[model samples]
Target: MTVQTSFESRSPATGEFLARHRVDSSVAVDAAVRRARVAADWWAGLGFTDRRRRLLRWKHVLVRELDGIAELMHQETGKPVDDARLELVLAVDHLDWAAKHAGQVLGLRRVPSGLLGFNLAASVRYLPFGVVGVIGPWNYPVFTPMGSIGYALAAGNAVVFKPSEFATGVGVRLVETFAEAVHEQPALQAVTGFGDTGAALCRSAVDKIGFTGSTATGKRVMAACAQSLTPVLIEAGGKDAAIVAADADLGAAAEAIAFGAMGNAGQTCVGIERAYVVDAVFDRFIERVAAIADRIRVGAEPQAQLGPITMPAQVSVIRRHIEDAIARGGRAVVGGPESVRPPFVHPVVLVDVPEDSEAITEETFGPVLVVNRVRTLDEAVDRANSSRYGLGSAVFAGRRTATALAHRLHAGMTSVNGVQSFATVPSLPFGGTRESGFGRIHGADGLREFARPQAIARQRFRSPANLLSFARTARDMRVPMLLTRSLHKRG
Candidate 1:
């Protein structure tokens, strides 16, 4: 008998074994996709009203079991309970939004067919792509993956989720709970394992793929999907930065920047890895940031402000970035070399780092921040936009200045006075540009992302000219030229 392969999930906080999950082979992934195909047809046939009802029930189930799911998230991802709860709450809110707004966002609507089609009635609608494959990340597993899953399901497609290996237990719980709301239909299912399983999901028969991971891995996922001509949505890494103007609120900027950098142990893709403050206020901002960093307690305890790194190997990476900054003449304003202790990395605040240093250019997926001073707000914007990442950014300034500066940012989402506030509003689309990856998840655009636009036209009347029949009409050809000349002749 062939033995089945399995992997174990251990708490990064204490290295305690949490749960075991079977490694799904490519054959298993194919089977799941097939099941999803059947479920997609049934779900889509139910129409928007019935599907919305089912999804709302699923949302209710999630809300009722939020505590249990949050606990599993804490154990599997090594995040504090409150952090887990916060993430879960956001995920559930997205679920509710997606379910309630999907129909209106994607339903068929009358559209202008232009002057050439005056005799025809035209409409357009978003149609499901059948089955969608999702490759989730370990950090914020609940919130991140649901950004794709909830929207995809609301758009009338079945989902085959492949959660990160470290968060397999949490993935399983989510699938089970969703199953209760959608009994007997394989509308939502999870395939567990390591990278191989995720690779399998990419190559499965799903109609589209929603991937969240490093940029390097995202390229591989895209390549795999290319084999079958399947469409894909990639949500990758970011070296997000925050800009603090001379006229900005230094205290609020410090508090927001510190939380943006240290929250979730800095595993977020849109977290503030770098901060550029105006020279006039840089000193005060640094002082406030350091004080806030000092107050953060890194542990698995309830009172701790931040938790351990979910990935053990990331510890060395964090250490390397910090050391590289210091070796290159950067000064540690708060924690430094001693900050990285195994799975937990105490927040490290560095300043005077070179703009070209790895600390500024790279995505340090750890609780570390590098603050740099610029002579003016223009200089701050230039330095902030210099990185290859264009994910999420924050600008702290007066309303007009902040708005003006925000427009100049290269990132996909920019907050005027807060950090990551755009992510909380379900109406705004979230994603990035450049190496951070393409495509979006959230709101109306998110629902449309999982679907394809289909146009419909009905002949309400026949044109006297019979222009489309090609019945050798000289006027048919001359009429368009005359109309074009009259309508678009340098008006």
Candidate 2:
């Protein structure tokens, strides 16, 4: 007889295992994809108006059960209830927005046939890609994954979600709510397991995959996806930086950095991992941040300002970051390497860390920040852009700070005077350009990612230059070049 052991999931607030079930070793994720494939036709046939109505009702269910949903997330991840509420609220808004905007964004729109091709009428419409597979992270599980799931569903593609093992309960509850709204249809299905389950989802016959996790895991996921030639959107981890100018509001900057860095025990991918302040105001900014961070407290209760580290494996990563920082002549004014108090790791503030140090070079993914001083904004931008990870960034500058620094930072999303505020606005596209991964997860970009544009051009009448027929001649291409040169030539 063979006995299989299980991986136990525990609550970060309390050292108690929450669930211990045998892992699902099924390699049949293709069936889940097929179910979704069938569901896609039914879902898309709803046309945008009916889809909007259904999704609206779904959003209502989410709003009605917001408290319960938040509690489940809080209990599973050990994040504050308020924080969970924050994420769910955004997700709710996105569902409503996506449902309403899908028709307009994905609807067929006519394209102009240039003067040379006047005989042809052309148009393009975004068509659903059948099925999309989403592998979500534990931190901000709702908001992050919904960016893809909600949009994919709205665009008429069926979604199969694989939530993080640690947050599977939360995923189940969300899916249960959707089932209540949509009846017993597998429009959205949740598969629970460890990395194997996730890899299966990737290897399974899905049109596209959207993954959010660490960089190393992201590469592995990409490799797996490559096996099936599956297109993927990887919202990998980031080492985001916040720059504080000398003329900025020191108090607000400090508080923003503190909350942005320490929120959710710093298990955030876009969290403020580093802070670069001008030498003229570095000392003042450091003082303000240290004071604010020290005042913040972590507790097991739901009302606590901060909570515990959700993933147990991350505890070691956090410790190593702090220890490495301290060992390399970095000073921790507020908290240090021994800050681990069981499930919760208290906030730590480091200063005077070399830009080339391990703490600055690697992603800590904890409630910690590495502060450095630069002589000029040029130096600040250089240091911020030095890292391989450029997922997100923030700048505290004068009136032109956001506009000017926007061009300097190499990341996809950057917020001025706020930390990660770009993510809240539904108009902007989220997801990074570099190691953060490609493909967008919000706004128009989100809608397009799950769609394939089928370009159709019908000839109203036989063109004088028939490019597709044997009668066509190479001379047909000369008209376009001549027109282009005539319109803009110096002569």
Candidate 3:
């Protein structure tokens, strides 16, 4: 008899074994994709109206069991209950929006055929890719992956989700809830395992893959998908920054920066990893941030404001970055390297960090913030844009200054006066540029991302000025040139 293989998922808070999940082999992943393909046809036939209604039902199911799912998220990810609840709330909101807005966003729309093709009618519609494979991260297990899964399903595709091994239970629960919503189709499923499982999903016969994880892992996922000539969308790592202008609201800025940098132990892809403050308010900003950080509790307690570093290995990375920053003329105003206490890392605020140091350059997915002072807002913008990863950023300034500074950053999403709140707004597209990865996963753009656009042009009536037919004469082409010159030449 062949022995069954599996892996253990342990709690990051106590290092206790939580559950055992099968390690999905290449064969298993291929089977899941094949099942999805079979279900995709039935799902697509449901049409926009029916699919929209069914998806709203799915959203209702998600809302009904939100508490239970949040608990699972807390157990698997070691996040506080409140934090898990907040993540679930945002995820449910996205699902509702995706379902409600799918028809208007992806339905066929008439397009102008132009004067040159006046005899033709043109329109375009988005078609689903049949099947989508999603590789989710553990940090924001439900919210992050659902950004792809919810929109893809709304766009008429079956999804096979592969959750991070550390958070397999949460992924399974989400799939089960979806299954309950649309049981006749069974179009949604989960495959749980480690790196090999994710790689297998990428290589499977899915039409596209939506991946959320580290930049290194995203490259690997993209490479695997490339083997099959499959299209992929990646939401990778980030070293996002928060820029505080001299004219910014100090109290509000300090609160936003502290929460943005320390929430979920700073494991968010769009978390405020660095801060650039104008020289005039640098000292005052640090003082306010430190005061705020000192009051935030970090532990596994129910009331704790911050939680453990879900990935065990990240503690060391956080320690290394903090030490490197301190060694290179940086001062720790709040916590320090010693703050990395096993699973729970308290907040750490480092001031005057060098630009070239690892703490400023690398993605330390822990509750650590590095603040630097700049002579001018332009210098701060220049320094923020210097990073290789440009996922998300925050700008706190006067209305005009904030808008101007936001335009200068290279990030995909910039929250003016807030920190990453754009993520909660379902109408805005979210993703990154540069090393942070490509493609979007929210709003109308996200619905279209899981689909392919096909354009149709039909001849409404037979015209003497036919241009696309072999019967067209050279005189027909001359007419267009003459019209172009008359309409556009130096006019």
| Candidate 2 global lDDT | 0.86
Per-candidate count of clashing residue pairs (backbone under 3 Å): 0, 0, 0
As a whole number from 0 to 100, the lDDT of residue 211 in candidate 3 is 96
* Model 2 steric clash pairs: none
Alpha-carbon deviation at 327 in model 2, angstroms? 1.3
> How would you encode candidate 1's per-residue C-alpha lDDT over 368-475 as one tens digit per residue?
999998998888889989999899999999898999999999999998889999999998999999998999999999999999999999989986556778584887
Q: In candidate 3, what are the lDDT values of residues 440-491, reduced to their tens digit?
A: 9999999999999999999899766767789889887888889999999984
Candidate 1, superposed: residue stretches over 4 Å from native: 1-4
Task: For candidate 2, write residues 117-225 as lDDT tens digits.
Answer: 7998999999888889999999988999999999998898889998988888888778888888887468898877789889989888888999999889999999998
Worst 10 residues of 2 by lDDT: 20-29
Cα lDDT for residue 225, candidate 2: 88
61 in model 2: Cα distance from truth in Å? Answer: 0.7
Per-model TM against the reference: 0.98, 0.96, 0.98
